[model samples]
Target: MSGYLALLGSSFEFFCLVILDLERFALAGQPHWDELEATLQRLENDPDRGFHDLAAAQRFHYLYQRAASDLGRLASFSAETSLRRRLEGLVARAYAELHSAREARDTRWRPLVWLLETFPRTFRRHAGAWWLAVAVTLLGSVVGAFLVAADPEAKASLLPFGHGEMNPSERVAKEEAGRSKGLANRRSSFAAELMANNIRVSLKAVAFGLTWGIGTLAILFYNGVILGGVMLDYLRAGEGLFLAGWILPHGSTEIPAIVLGGQAGLMLARGVIGWGARVPLGRRLRAIAPDVATIIGGLALLLVWAGIVESFLSQYHEPVLPYWLKITFGVANLAILGAWLFLCGRGPTPED
Candidate 1:
């Protein structure tokens, strides 16, 4: 009789365990069912929305994964046919939606779309930092230029490669000869070298932010001084027009890229400094990662375009194209870039 009683007690406990498992499964799936249904409804109502919106897409993905996990759990333990069926259907729908979105993003034009829509929007969010970088560089250039203009002796310290040692006429002659040789004889090699050097400089500026942005600032200041000194020397030599023609075409793009790189570095530095300390240092750095990537990507594209222009159109074409024409080309390029940055991807404002 005791043995019979023990078997009965064990069976009862097993039944209770099964009942508890069923309850847990139902509770787990209930919330996910409601959310999945709502999200599906929203997606169906607005087919054009959600997929491109990063937040919405992430939410949908999260909900989908939850629903899928619930489906698996219910299939394994739940005897309720209706509950399992409902969850299975929801999972199927979500899988389809996610797959479709993924396919759409796989299109070739998706990268261009990202560049046009995402890059600028991200950059605009950090416009203050970018503008600060531009201001610092411009101020440095002005100070350097003024110093060179005020004191001839300052040229030796500011100018690279002892350019200060050359007399005005000698400097002018050397500049003209270098330009002629590069353009007339070694245009391809010159362009390649210039592009490589410019890219290296921009990358250095961005990487130097690891030093808390001091390295970045120093690079900008040093380059600014070199530019100012060279400009002054050319102007004094009465070759101002020549300088303008030679520099503007590539400088318009190259300089802006460098500034953008500096801006990225500053953004990184801000993350490192933890100005408010509201978030942990690691979190702050992670937050700025996307912005840094966008800025660097944009800078790289600009550099490639600048390199092409510098090599093919800016350097050797001076003999074929008048200086005014080259200047006009530079202006046109700048205008297009400005419009793209400021205006492109900004659709019509919704009616308030």
Candidate 2:
């Protein structure tokens, strides 16, 4: 009986010792775990840095082994289940890093090549979609102009954003007489707002392709109608030169940007339709995926430039900046943009 009682006491003592040991080990290893986490984070954050430091590699390996050992020791105890799980995760991550045998290909970003070559080439490849967008817009414009010209009352319904309320000639006179100063202190804010509004419109044009391009067509047509109505209004008011100087400076870029967005939408629609293509839906989409991204990139660049031009140059009417000068700038800008899109990427590159 005494031997049995002594054995029970010794078992209780062993239990107490295990609990104490668990507490001590957990406390001691926390710092190592933290160090390992920090090291892993550094490696993950900078792929370019790579595993160049031998000391770090050795320390990482050692920490992983220690965590694994701790995990094994904790297996018999249920009280430290959470710690065991954490250690397991850390050990697994470390193992992956240590055992990775494949050398990853280094890919660096080259913005210039993408901008100068890729963007325009993708645009040219999808020119059919752009032309279709242009045709739909032109049709709408013609319809809008005819409606407004036949019935002056139609301007109120067709023209939006209070444009129909203002007489174009009066507005031009006010702008030339220094109402243009309204944007002086607020040019940057105005520019930012313009960019946001135009970019949002462009993105919607791209997103609407999900409707098999009906939505995209509607957006393009509506924009064109609005543009045509406004142009006709200014011309009727005998403010044609002012209209040209005002709209052309930014419209040269902004209009094309919207059209390109429609182009992207049409491309997405084509991928969805897979009309003549026998490939699977996934493959068709995959083929045009890069092209869609390329078009979006171009649209963004064009809109940003347009926003700057509208805010900085377009608003400065005749007195602040000559009408003739603005007209010339607009013409030159359009010509240069046309050449960049159509001619720049046509032939073989010097590298070829």
Candidate 3:
């Protein structure tokens, strides 16, 4: 029971983290050499929340300095130069900073590593709250679906939250409905395009976690409800079982990762809100960062699985196995998620 609580808490935490960071990352396109360094300095100077570890703080500072210097060289490139030359240098600096940070974990901040290793162990730590979060999300979804089902006009409105300048669903629908030869091949031929679309959708969902996690519990609640409604709609249309068959294989990997990404956003939110809680900000954030990264990294892997599912598994027009087999696989998937949460490692400190 304790382990289950911990997993629930961790899931909530990851969900919050992704929601908070996504918008920021998109608008700014990730921290450049100078920006990341500035963020570190800013974090140190924060009155409510500052770095408790000097070595970790200094290491980030050093990385920023190197990044800054590299950016300086890149800035000198002429406008006529292609992007490959400019991006290569920037990419190298980012990787270097990331690697150095990882190396410092072993030498300067072993506790940070221990904390990360121990995180999955706490799967049962906040069992009550974890269950509550899921319940709240589930209830919200049920209500949202009820509202949509109650009104045919509102159904279209519930399609999705459009990012960027246009609606992706609308664009895709148009492309698929067109009569062009290009569309013909996409419909009847290769799987690459389908894989690409799946990847895009999964990434968008993961990215949205940043907003859902950081904005507020309301944001997370809304996303949960939206997802529920979408799935519920298919189920009502007698496609529920078929949709489940298509989604389960990849969704096993995809959905949890998105939820985890949301946890990351929550981490950022906790940092910002301070929750009026007694804990120091630095420690709280440090605990949150790695977990956030873990989920984000997990999301990337899930996208790959999603591609496979979309390209091949979902393409299966007929059910290939018995109903029991599908149920077994589905249960197995949930069990694996459960095990990952509880059995991985013990938490470093009992309290967050």
Candidate 4:
């Protein structure tokens, strides 16, 4: 009986040593796993551009295969259950990333095809989030319009650059003159500036979502207030028609892009806030990252188009182009955008 007891004690000690050795091996591989994950994340975020990094791709492949082998060894040897589970998850993720990257590489125009097809489908799938963002912005705009209309002094606090001091007529006159002198004279520079500004605003809207979405909402609301106040001021100055023509030309595309940016922020907020608690927060964030990139890319393209219209077509008032024609063109452009987004990619295809 004493010999049997000694034997049991020795076996327990040996088991402990095995655990320690296994732990050491796991720890040794952790940094490589982390580096592989980071590279995978970068590739996932911008798959089209990321595939160009051949070194990173090779590194990921090496680490992934190594991880798979480790996982197999751990499973076969009956390693600690916890460590085995972790390795399993790591191997699964690496496999998915490797598969996706390989598939993307197989299709040279996959990015463009995704933009044309998969992107719209993805956007439509999240239409509820987008519309919610639009509703918030519109509600803010209405509140702003009512406030400025009810209390003329409110404009002082709302409008930027002391523009509130100038009555509606002065504001309209200045805008008209600026458009004529700046946009008409230096179209290229003006377009570039406008595009840059819009891009900045859109980026801010998306970035601020990291703060649990409050920052994004605040930005959208403040911009809405400024727009509403400006519009009311113009209408009060009896330049309603002028304001419509001035804004609609570019506003058609620009407004939707801004709203989409807000939507992206809201999605980020959803992940950070862990809305459903069904999935792990980290997984939720990973799932949404690609969608956020797609939305931002679409917004950038839309802003470019808007900048062009604002710089060229919108500036041509009176004899150069009638207000009626501008409004018609704006409506037509919006219709085209609507059709492209909702109907263009409905055919039977994997991307669609």
Candidate 5:
């Protein structure tokens, strides 16, 4: 008995189904069958023409269920072989259309949505790990700052790119005097090098989770030490403006990207440790793998942008680009990145 329509309570469309014989039932269902078939044909012919509205998609699912019910009923009528076969085929096609793996992918994967929404949501979901990374880096910075303040000569070993032996004030003077032309003819190549190097470093931060996070923590701490040493050195030289201008443009994004990698690494280590979790180690690792991958992917994009800025903009000094203006740009960039991470995806849309 296809009496489910009784819920409609005398609706004109379903009224005939309440007490119809086989022939009458066939007559009534024929129109709906034709409609479902036509919709399916349209979908097959124009694969990209997905349902445009919730109502239409709902109708399609309802039609599928109805066709399936009709096929089941036809199974009892031995003389209705032709009708049964036709309906079975239609029901099968409708089922495939609704559940096809390709359609499932199309429905779930939206790149822009993932970028602006899903990535932020995922990062927020695992923000504890990221904050932990920040804290570790901060601790390392403290240690590095202490060492630099105590021993001025430590800068040689504490700094890189030949910043050790030279005074920060002298470097700033030279750069402002237009001696920063080191990459003038090779800006593109330098930018590419920065991108590749930074991405590799970030990936290493993530990959180090295989060591149960020890290596990841070390990498993060070392980075913090470098930053702290540089900051203390420049500020000591009364080059605070130069430091802010030089670091902020790229560091605004680059530092966070690296920290994000550390976050992913910590997350992986958490899975490996599974301290409070009751699941099997393998299952735990598998569960967190996607989150790790997503964070890494987002950070890679951030690093690319940071690398470009570092080479093309961050390298230019005071007279060419005012320190105040550069510092303002960096502050703005930092604020934007912070807002995007903290607020972008916290709307009505489902987070997962």
Candidate 6:
């Protein structure tokens, strides 16, 4: 038993060293990728080892398998370092594929659906900081709402924007009514317009991620403050129940989707900023391709959902259901999103 334990410890140590070595090479200006693959292969040969050696051995084996499979992709190319170069080729191919898919009558929906399926995992893996920012913003809004609700006098000036004497909520109602009337003639166009606006906003959130994420935070803060002010206004009007009708109907999906878009922006930004040292151009592109695909794909899904909510659900501003029922629907929406984000297993990361 002592000998077995000793062997297990040594094996574990070796396994760690192997991983560190691979990581180091990957971070180094010139990655010794072939060497990493060789090490993984050797580790996997230790079949005689028992449970104690399982963890390290399995890791090495997995890395080795991935490297082998990825490296083998070179057969399709005539260039040296074909696997890496081929990955660099992704930008043009992706753009063309997506564009062509959209233009082709039979293929338009397929490309969009593909993007929806792949983007969440990438965003989830690379968006830790941005996601935290979103969480903080949401939590702050909730707390601020409760505070305003407690003592109206304490927050008499809570809403800073002017309603020109109509009061905040009344102003909003008038504006909303005007917008609805303007949109009455073109429902499909309105949905498309909203979808385009949402996509543009989400893309900007991700694109600015290249700037160390400060830009993303600024955008999120703007949104949070606006929401907090609206909540305060609603509570002030003694219309908490009515507010639920306005928000809970479609906000359940819309709000989360916006947050998710922010997260995707952060992920893309990390790649642009070289989360690890700038990789070989080929290696870098290969590493980040899947993530780019994920962001675009996720936005497509969000647009569809947002269109449904905006066109159908949001128009019905009367809370037909009881408070508990509305709350339940809100909870259910969050639960489904949570399952997709954290619980669902897809490859090693969400994007895969």
Q: Count the backbone clashes (under 3 Å) in each candidate.
A: 0, 0, 41, 0, 0, 8
Report the alpha-carbon TM-score of model 4 versus the true structure: 0.70
lDDT of 6 by residue, 1-352 (tens): 9999999986775455445443332243123344443443442353223224667546544544444443443334354464456333432333343344333324224553444344444555665755675875686576556656665553545444341123546644564455434345576777777788777766676666667767875666555654676677676787676567556655776666666667765665566666566586456645766566566666567667777666655544433335555556656766876676665445453223
In order of appearance, the predictions have TM-scores of: 0.66, 0.70, 0.49, 0.70, 0.71, 0.53
lDDT of 3 by residue, 215-295 (tens): 434544666667666766666656655556555765665555545444545555555456666788776666656555554
Better of 2 and 6 by TM-score: 2
Tens digits of per-residue lDDT for model 1 on 1-352?
8999988985675455445666755665577689888889887677556665788778888999978876765666545688778888889988987887754433333577667876777677778778888887877888878988899898877787567786756644554455434356676787777778888998898889879889888877777777777787778778777677777888889888888888888888889888877999899988898789888988888998898889887764434667888888888888877777777667632221
Candidate 1 stretches with Cα past 4 Å from truth are 1-109, 161-180, 183-185, 348-352
Which parts of model 2 have CA positions greater than 4 angstroms off?
1-107, 179-181, 349-352
Clash number for candidate 1: 0
lDDT of each: 0.77, 0.85, 0.52, 0.80, 0.87, 0.56
Pairs of residues at least 3 apart in sequence or in different chains that clash in candidate 5 = none
For candidate 5, lDDT tens digit of each residue in 223-301? 9998899899999999998899999999999999999999999999999999799999999998898789899989999
Please write out the lDDT profile of model 2 over residues 1-352, one tens digit for every residue.
9999999986675565467677767776799988888877776677557567888778888998877877776788877778888888888877776665243333344688777887888888989999999998888888788888999998998898788787887788788788644686899999999999999999899999878898999999998999888989889889999999999899999999999999999998999889899999898988888789889999999999999999999988888799899999889889988988887777785447
Window of ten residues with lowest summed lDDT in model 1:
101-110
Model 3: lDDT equals 0.52
| Candidate with the larger lDDT of 5 and 6 | 5
Which numbered prediction scores highest in lDDT against the true structure? 5
How well does model 2 score by local distance difference test?
A: 0.85
TM-score ranking from best candidate downward: 5, 2, 4, 1, 6, 3
Query: Positional deviation of 146 in candidate 2, in angstroms?
Result: 1.4
By lDDT, highest first, what's the ranking? Answer: 5, 2, 4, 1, 6, 3
